[model samples]
Structure formats: C-alpha cells, structure tokens
Target: NSFGSCSRGCTTIDKLHWWGASIGNAGCEELSTQLVSASKPYDGKPARMVKNLLLGGNMVGDACMGALARAAAKGALKDVGALGLSRNSIGDAGVKALAEALAADVLHPGDLYISGNRFGSTGALALASALSESAAMRRLERLSLADNRIGDEGAVTLADCFATGGARQLESLHLHNNNIGDEGVVAIAQVLSRTAMASMTTTADTKKSEKGIFRTTFETIGTLERLFLCTEGAAEKPQEDLPPAELLPPLYCLRTLNVGSNRASTRAKGALAGMAAQRSVECSV
Candidate 1:
C-alpha cells in the first residue's frame, strides 16, 4: 500500500498502548508492509522520538520485517533507545533483517533485547556482527542475546566484531543460554583486554590537548562502566571431572559470568577454580 495508509496505521497505534489481541498480528503485518514501502521514499529526516519498539507477541511473518524496521528507524525514529523482539514471534530471517536494519545507523544505539527466538549460528552471527558494526549501537550500555542457538562459531564471530573499533562504545554484553564455551569466553576476554589497553593508551595521548583529554576521559569512563559480561544458562555445564585449573586464568576481566541451570560436573568446577585462582573471574552456577 501507500505511505499514507501505512502512516495512518502507525499513527493509530502510536499512542494506544494496547491494540487488542485479535488485531495485533494483522496490525503488525500491516505496519511492517507500510514501513517497507515508506523506507524507499525516505528523506533522511527524523520521523519520531520513538523510545521503545516492542514486537513481542505480534505473529508477523518473516518476509521483510528487517527492512521495515530499518525504514521505521530512519529519521524521526532515529532516537529510539530500546528495541525488543523476544519469544517465538519472529523467525530467524525476520530477526536477521531487524538486526541488519538496526546496525545500519550509528545514531539509534540503546538497549537491544532479543531472546527466546530459535536463531541458529548464522542468524546469531549476523545479528551480532550488525550490532558490532553500528557506531550507534556501540554507544549502547547494554545488549542481551539470550536463549538463541548460537554456537561457538557464532560466539567467536560476535567477539571478533566487538573487538573491532565499531564496538568501542559498548558497556555491557549478555550472551546467555548459547553454546559458547571456553573458546568463546577466551575470545571475549582477549577483546576486553585489547579495549582496556587501547583506552589507556588513548588517555595517555591527551597530554598535548588538555581540553580534549578531559572530554575523552569522561566518555571513556562512561563506556567502561557499562561493559558487563553476563553469560547465564549457557549450554556447557561444569563437569565433576576437573581438568587442570591452569586454563581458567584468562577470563579474569568478566564482570558477571552466569552458568546457572547447566549440568556443571566436577571437572567443570576444577577448571573454574583454576581460572579463579589465576584471575578474578566471578561466576554463578
């Protein structure tokens, strides 16, 4: 349909909190369709001050939801701080599209919560890479990617992306209930170490410009405060048969490591103990 029709539908539900259960699915689909159409003629102007976009229960089929979400995010909605798409509502393709759209802009950074959706390694990596590449998303202080089927490969890709300069503004990262094991954790740790070093070096270079140094220091502190690594309910459980504790020393920088509800055996505990002994890695099982 035309932008006018889509705009009207968006406006209808713009202020209304509840759009009724019966029409929720249809409404979302209509909105998605309209958004896709509108994005083509987008003028790069701010559209709205959308603080939150919640598409949890709306069973909108996955065709171009990503593009549509991106289109809605253009100008007016650029300042959107929160985007929630959880549960089994949207398919992998839809989720991927949404992430791709969100990553396109460096201005729409905030909290992104996507959980309970059965995304495979490819989808997980796509979403993670998108977020990592978005300068705006890097400014975010929190990101949650829980309950997805992201394996070690996906985790490695995400860790690499975050390590890139694109994610310099990150403060927190949550990847719980995925299959990211010791290798994934190691990748994340390496990134954190690199970022910390880079931040320190940047601060040291500010001796020449006092004014710039002050601003940089403030921004750097803000970024670090938000950097949290929380991995609760991950796939691998700590085993009873402990490996040499020497392997655990590398993950000391992690703020909150959650491995609850997993089948951590004795071996797992030993490995964790070894890590704790080498470096202070707080963990919950």
Candidate 2:
C-alpha cells in the first residue's frame, strides 16, 4: 500500500530515502518494477527524476540487487548520482550484477556506498574489473567498501586499477576493516608515491608566473584525496617481485590516509609514513 503510494509519488520526486525499512526481496522487486515504468517516456512529462536512492539496512539480498541491476541496464535510474546499499545482505552475485551495468555504461554513480555487505575478494575483483573496463566509472568520486572482507588480493587488484588510470576522478576511498595486509597497503602506497613523483614533474615544468594558478592548472592533478585502511591484519608473508619504486609512475592526489589498528611491521609502517610525508599527505597509522 505504502509502496504503491511511493511509486505514484516518485514520478515527481528526485530522491528516495528508505533505509532500515526492512523492505526485503518482495519490496525491492516491486520498487524495481516502478523504476522500469518510470524510465520510459510518459505523456511528455519528464521521466522519473530520482537522483539518489538510499536503500541500506533494508535486508535486501543478492536477488533484489539483481532486479535493480536489470532495471539499471534498461536505462532506469540513469540520473542517480548517489547510491547507498550499505548494511544489506548483498554478496558477490549482487555485486557482479551491478558491475555488469557499470561495465555497460548504463549506471554511473558519483558516490557508491556498499559497505557492511557480505562480499569478499570475488566481489571486489568484479568491481575492480568493472572500474578498469568502464570509462563511465571515471565519474565516481567517493566509494565506501569498508567493513567487508575484501582481503589482500582484492586490495591489490583495486590498486592495479588505479595504476591503470581507472577511476580517475575518485577522491575518497574507504576500505577500513576489510582485512587488508601489508602487501596490499604497500601496493597502494607504491601507486600513490609514484603518482606524487609525476605530479612533481608537472610542477617543475610549470612557469614561475603560472605557479600561483594551481587550481586552474592542476585541479585534476591528483587521483585520490582521502584513503581509509584501518583495522587491517598483517600479511603472513611479504609480496615479492615488487617493481622498484622509481620505476613506477607518479600519484599526487592523496591527502589523508588511515592505516591504524593493523599488524603491518614497523618497517612497512615507517616506509608508508615516509612516503606520505614526502607527498605532504596526512598519515594516521
């Protein structure tokens, strides 16, 4: 009853905040139908204007997210800039479904929150692959994957995505409590340090008079601003075959990094701190 009312009223609305409503599979299915309906041209009225959809804590699972993913692929929710699915029962299947839409360029979210779900390396890898493959993913600004179990393998893949120039506009990345280890953190740090060097080269190439025009010249110079990696565990063994730091490219956009509560060795932590200091990035480890 209420859902029907919402569907009818949503035609004019631009955001839906229904978190913690316990709207499970059935409710999500119904909502997805409305989304598809609203996507089509309707009597010359502007199609559904929903720009933000908050459905966290609703007990939604993979099946429901799959329905939403299908709707997204069909051009529904095209205007969504922020999507919140935190604290749900989503797993790899659900994440993979959404990744398909992302890869197909049907879903472009500036901010995506999927923390506290039930996905691990497979889901993380899927998302990383999508980010690498989808040019549309460059619109992503903030991503929250904290409190899940994307371990070191997942972290390395995501780092590789950055290395490959994916998610170029991403600013904030939250990966706290994800069971990341020293190898993962080191890989990410390596990317950041390399990026910083590149930024330095650009800075050196600039004319003295144009230095003051920082924002206008280098607004998009950095790839990330804030990174969270708290509560990670130590690696059982170190990663080998790491490329020499000088051989890597530069990364200059990071500002804040949280690597506390982890078991990374003192040497690794010191190296991270030194790198952060070199880049003038705030380090909390």
Candidate 3:
C-alpha cells in the first residue's frame, strides 16, 4: 500500500518511532507528508491513531521541523499525546515553529521531550510563553529540555511564567544540564514561593466560605465522649459566597524539578531548598 493510505493496517499505527534513523531533512519531509495525509479521518473511521511521535537523533533541521509543526498546528495530529524530539539539529527557528503550534492548540500532549537540541534562549522564551499562555498546555504533565543552551534569561523567564499562573498541572520539569546560573535559580525559587503562598491563601479563603459542609462535632457524656456527625444544609447548593475555583490560580503541582549540572551556586541551592521546603517540592540542584 502507498504511504498515507488508510489501507493495510496504516490506520492502526498508534506510535511513530523514528529516533536515530539518520533520516535527513528530505526524508523527514517525505515521512511528514505521509503522516499528515494519513492523519485525516475517513469513512467514519478514526484518523491515524498515532499518539506518540519520536524523532530524536534523526538529523532533523529547521526546514522539516517547521513543516511538521505547521502540519500539526493545522490539526493534522490532533490525537498525538506525546512528542519526543531530543538530540536533533533543530535551531531557534524550528523550536519557535513548534512553540507556535503548541500555543495554537495543535495537540494536547501530556509529555514533551526536546532535550539535546541546538536551540538557545530565544527558543526557550517562545516555549515558556506557550506553556504559560496556552489553555491547552494545562494538561501537560511532564516536560524535559535538558542538554540545551537555554541560559539565565530562559530560566528567569520560566519563573515569570509560573508567576503569571501557568503550568498548574505540571508534575515534573527536567531542566538539567542547561546554562542556568545562580540568579536564575533564585528567581525561579522566589516566584514559586510566592505562587505557593497565594495558593495557600486561596485554599484558606475557600474553606472559610464553605458554610454548609458536613462536620463532626464532639459531645461530652457523663462517662465518655461521643462523636456526632451533622450537616445543616450540606445537600443544598453552595451559597453565592462560594468563590469560583477556576477564577483563582491553582496551586503549583510540580512534584519534581531537575536543575542539576547547571551554574547555580551554593547560596542559590540553599534558597531553592528553602522554597522547596515551603512548597514541598522535590528539587535536584
């Protein structure tokens, strides 16, 4: 069967593993064309079922990467849930294209790996913007960008991203082996600290506004203490005083943050540890 044809089990492909294939730009462009064509739904059947696309170490460059990003942005890869593009030759232009696609809600990937690339602060800044501003990126659980050239500027901007209330559901962030410095790490810690405090205050205020939640009370008998569970109007709808949870920025959900092998100093590490202690974050400095 021809490439991109829905025949011959092509429609059942759930993952595209092309890592270290040495497929140059032209080759990748060809494969991308086929995949994009195959991704369209036909005859009441689901589109190409690819949820994971790995193209690491393929000598992929800006041209093909741009093409793929454009295709994905146009909704050709709507079902993709993970993307791995580590150890490529992609530069800032390519990375920016991918960032644009993500910002445009091309695919709702839970995990994105772009480590060991040839991008720098510019690309990282674009990615940070997308992560912070895009509603679709809220589902992102894990992101890895290790072994790149993103420096202090990128790191500080990432901190700003969190301050602007982004990546609420992010569970892990891998930024090891980058060029981040002490100031960058400190900035990140401070912003995270502030965000955590805000989250705590929001939680407290929400609890205070809950007027009719069921609560257990204690009553002292002559010989023993008895527990009494009561609810005044728990079954009723919440009062107008109940705040809109969505309107408030959610607590940062990061469980692990890897910033090791960078340029941070001991003082920065101490600050990071303090922030982690306050927010219960696991940090690798």
Each candidate: RMSD: 11.6, 10.3, 10.0
Question: Which pairs in model 3 have colliding backbones?
Answer: none
Q: Which candidate leads the pack in TM-score?
A: 3
Per-residue lDDT of model 1, residues 1-285, tens digit only: 101122211433232122223334456656555544533435775333434555554444355365456455555346446555555455668767777776777235455656666776788777777765664554454566777767667777877775554343333456667766666656655655544443342121123243342211222322232232212211122322211222112221344444333333545534544543333345443
Spell out the clash pairs found in candidate 2: 194-249, 194-250, 194-251, 195-250, 195-251, 196-251, 198-250
- Candidate 3 per-residue lDDT over residues 1-285, each given as its tens digit: 001223221224776767688888898788778777778878898777577777778898888778888778657767666777888888889889888888888865777888998888899899889887687776676788899988899888777777675665566788899889997889888876774665443222323324565422212111111011011221122434322323433325666788899989989978887887776778888
Residues 224-281, candidate 2, lDDT per residue (tens digit)? 3212111111111121211122233433334556665555667766777788787786
lDDT of each: 0.49, 0.70, 0.70
TM-score of 2: 0.77
Off by over 4 Å in 1: 1-25, 33-48, 73-76, 192-203, 207-285
Question: Can you tell me which runs of candidate 2 are displaced by over 4 Å?
Answer: 1-12, 203-252, 256-263, 282-284
